[model samples]
Target chain A: MIRVLEQIGRVFLRLFEETGLWFTMLWRTMAWSVRPPYGVGEWFRQMVRLGVDSIPVVFLTAMFTGMVLALQTFIGFQRVHAESFVGSVVALAMLRELSPVLVGLMVTGRVGSSMAAEIGTMRVTEQIDALEALATDPIQYLFVPRVIAGIVMLPFLVVLGDALGIGGGYLVAVRLMHANPVQYEINTYQFLDMNDVWSGLIKASAFGLILTLTGCVRGYYTTGGAEGVGRSTTAAVVNASLIILLSDFFLTKLLF
Target chain B: MTVATNMEPQSDPNAEPMISLQHIYKSFEGKEVLRDLSIDIARGESVVIVGGSGTGKSVTLKHIIGLLRPDSGHVMIEGRDITEMRPVELNRFRQHFGMAFQEGALFDSMSVFENIAFPLRRHTKMTEEAIAARVEECLEQVHLHGVDGKRPSELSGGMRRRVGFARAISLKPEILLFDEPTTGLDPVISDVVADLIVEMDRTLNTTTVTITHDMKVAFKIADRVAMLFQGHIVEDGTPAEFQRSENPIVQQFIEGRAEGPLTDGTNE
Candidate 1:
């Protein structure tokens, strides 16, 4: 019993330690974000790297997800003679939850992992130390641009993802499933209040903060060597994915 | 426990040392790496610290640059204690230093020219034309030329170290710190690097401190050589005095012998 208790205590200690580290990183990034020499050039470059480059994959994922969701809901509603409601269901789900969560996960996998690996390699190779020795703040030079890009870009990506996803549902519903085109279009927008779209965008912004902060924090504290970079990359993807999922629930509760 | 008598450098008594480390004690994960270590380097002097691997040489350099803080000590630069400064103040304080790492640590994402140009772009308001000329001048100072368009990955180890040197000197810093500058170079290249250091020290006339275990490199570039053993300075003097010292550990290290107080069980 004593051994089990000790193990449990260790787990909680690690959790608290990690939480504090992430919060500290977030605080510093914010503090540096407002400082002079805004590094606007790097910020735009990262926006293209983290946001624009992610468009194709995010669109693909959202389209497929919406089609599958439409098909499943259509078939189930048909059993109850409520197949007409399929458009509403698909549109509501995509706008309120699916688009933000899926895009967050996708960006986490694509950009977050790369950020961790890049910074982690710099850490091990002593490049970061060289930066400090040159009288440059690693936080201002490195973290601010990436974090700002993430926070500003994830919502825009989700907005595009939402459009593609709904369009994909339309493709399946009208072309393949033979749902009434006019009725389906009307139902899609009828049930989606302005709140539904706002809530998802807000969640996307939160997810943006979470994924980028996690990547930077993991990369900054990385030790060991090449193996440590690999570990940070894997942890960045896994932890960002897990946090997006966990935060989605809380965000949904608060937003709704 | 054998401390050399010539632990102090032969400098003028009235002038302040350019850099001073006082009672520095540092450890990692409870393993003590530096214990009550202290050293004073005069302005415009070139000092080399010689120590074996894992002897906290890098840690000592890091402390001087504010990269790592000592557990209980003071790192003073130009009579100002840096240990109490905040992060922003420390960064401003560090503008006076130019540190070159063992592996060059050049940013792989940039070309050689950009690597050398980074500090000037960040710290100064030099226009593009002026920055380009300065980069060329710095590269020339390190005896490197026309490799600006290439990446660091495309350069040899010796060339990479030179590029790192060019970058370090770009800002014309007041103090220079070199961490094992010749660790992974051939003897010929190491000698060339040593020559470069001597030339830079003479031409720039800046205070410089280098940490290396290579006695040859130490003798070639250092005005004074200090030997670190068991987390403290065991011997410090001119190269001639250091070679003729009676300390068994310093003798063993200088001679590269395998059997002595350093390798024997007695020191532990």
Candidate 2:
């Protein structure tokens, strides 16, 4: 019993130290990120890639999700006289929950994983160190552009997701669920307030920053060889996904 | 060594030594690598430190260029202690030095032209046209004319080493460090790199520090040679002096002896 307890204590201590180092690095990276000598071209390029290029996939996901939600709600509301409220329900849910969560997940897989792998390769190849040797700060060259691109673009992508999802919900409710199109549109626009969109957008922005930062951090600290880089890439995806899920719950609670 | 010490000229009247390492000590984990290692490189002097693997040869180069910090010593560049430099000061100090890694650590994502132009784009205020001209001149210096659009992976080993040399001297840094410039190359390619080192040293008068296990390269380019053993410089002299050394470690190493002080011949 004593040995087990001692082992548990050691594990906890190790965890604490690891977490402390991670936070310290995160804070230092953030501090360095805001300072001058920004890479405008790289930031612009990443913004287009992360934001503009991702819009179509986000739109498709949101539209199908909204259609399904309206379908499900219609079946349940059929027995009661609550059919009129279906539009409101789907719109509110899509805007407040699904849009942010789905977009976050998609971007995590696409942009987050790529950032990790690219930076990990650079780290292993000594390109990052070479950048430092050339008097170009690696954080400014590498981290800030990705972080800025994520934060600036994710909110817009969330907005696109929210709009398309609500549109799909409208199409399903009015056409398939046998509701009046005008009335359904009115209900969705009226019931889904600005606060719903704003909260989801805020959460998306935070999620974007979190995922990119964690991915880059993991890749930057990777060691060993090819195996090391592979392990780091895997760890980056897993940890970014976990942080997104955990932070989503907290942000949802805090905002609501 | 005493004779070589007497031949050591006074410090340059117009400028200080390009780089100096004083009592630099480094250790990884519990193993000490460099112990009380001191090297003074005058302006335009080409110094080479020769040793077997794990004798802190590369670590010494890294210390001089401010890549790795020494545990209990100072790395002085142009009479300034770079170990205590702030981030900005260190970046400025870095601009004065260039390195060609053993494996030719060129940026894989960049084309040859871009890799050579990288430091100029990052550190200098030169215009794009001038940068291009400089890049061309540097490539020509390494005899790598054309092939600027090719990536590092597309290049052969000798080509990559020449590209590494081109990139190192692109900005014409005052001090250049080459970590095993001739490792794993054919005799002809090795001679090419050694000649470039000598030619660059002569043309640009750049103070050069080369770390190598290749005795031929050391004898060719080095004005002074230092042999590292057991974490300190056990021998320091000219190439001729090094060839005629009486120290068993130096003699054993030069003779490629697996016995004597190097191995103690005990593993059998």
Ten residues in sequence with the least summed lDDT for candidate 2 chain A: A18-27
Estimate every model's Cα lDDT from 0 to 1: 0.91, 0.84
Error of 1 at A91 (Å): 0.8
* Shift in Å, residue A154, candidate 2: 1.1
Q: Which stretches of candidate 2 lie over 4 Å from their true place?
A: A1-3, A76-81, B1-16, B264-268
Put down candidate 2 lDDT per residue, B94-155, tens digits, no spaces.
Answer: 88877888878888878999999988887778999999999999999888877899999999
* Candidates, DockQ: 0.91, 0.56
DockQ agreement of candidate 2 with the native complex: 0.56
Point out where model 1 deviates above 4 Å: B1-13, B266-268
Top of the candidates by lDDT: 1
Taking every candidate in turn, the Cα RMSD to the unseen true structure, in Å, is 2.2, 3.2
TM-score of chain B of each: 0.95, 0.93
What is the clash count for each candidate, in the order shown?
0, 0
Mind giving the per-residue lDDT tens digits that candidate 1 earns over B46-106?
Answer: 9999988888999999999999999998888998999999999999888899999999999
Question: What's the C-alpha lDDT at position A12 in model 1?
Answer: 100
Q: What interface root-mean-square deviation (Å) does model 1 yield?
A: 0.6
